[model samples]
Target: MLLHESQLAQGVFNLTWKVEMSGTIETGHVKWFNDEKGYGFISRDNGQDDVFVHFRSINSTANRKTLQEGQRVEFKVIKGPKGLQAEEVTAI
Candidate 1:
């Protein structure tokens, strides 16, 4: 995200820079998940906004891919249509 500084010196000024990379891997815990619905949100360890997670994004070897509440996981963050989403999620 780009951050702006509006107050600098006597005149208004703006400064911005990239605070995070687009493909950074993040660690978090499953805030809530619905096995039937196949979707959930993760509470990021870094304290950023929770990231949306879909069943298809999980890395699993079993027949069913699901996450439990408060389950630890690692994944890459990406910009989804609605907002930040978790991809390649793996239980850790």
Candidate 2:
């Protein structure tokens, strides 16, 4: 089946899948982070919009990982309650 057709089928059945049909995985820079609050915003290089990122979404191998301002990162944008939020964030 074609890609869009398959997606339409899934939508009809309410069967969600891990697919990149909507938004894209993008690269950006950490605009700022509040370690105390554990939340930050990323400046998207695509120039679409700034995405909200929480420390919990960060992918790190270290015991203590914190994002620094102006750090390059990669992430996927997902729909959040407030709007678009960043997920699976990682330092580049």
Candidate 3:
């Protein structure tokens, strides 16, 4: 959710506008992933902002926990320290 300065200013004064997460399970495609870094962003199918996905969140049966680019995945959305993050991610 990209916010303009005007909207941020208005929120500061009026305290109305805000970003909210539904905390629901969602499906998306892996936009890009760095296997070495063990982190990536998923392009949500719902057209929302991309959610950050950590390797730890990946549900893998193998030893390596990594996601490939363009892979389809299902995950739960959570409000992370930086922004929206993916949790309990599983390949679909």
Q: Which candidate has the top score in lDDT?
A: 3
TM-scores for every candidate against the unseen true structure: 0.75, 0.74, 0.75
Please say which candidate is ahead in TM-score: 2 or 3.
3
Off by over 4 Å in 1: 1-21
Q: lDDT for every model? A: 0.83, 0.83, 0.87
Write one digit per residue (lDDT tens) for candidate 3, span 3-60.
9999888768533322346667899999999999999999999998999999988999
lDDT of 3 at 1: 100
Give RMSD to native, each candidate.
11.6, 8.8, 9.5
lDDT of 3: 0.87
Expressed as tens digits, the lDDT of each residue in 1-92 for candidate 1 is 54445434213321122122366688999999999999999999999999889999899999999999999999988766466788899999
lDDT of 1: 0.83
Q: How many backbone clashes does candidate 1 have?
A: 0
For model 2, residues 15-40, the per-residue Cα lDDT tens digits are: 33333324667999999999989998
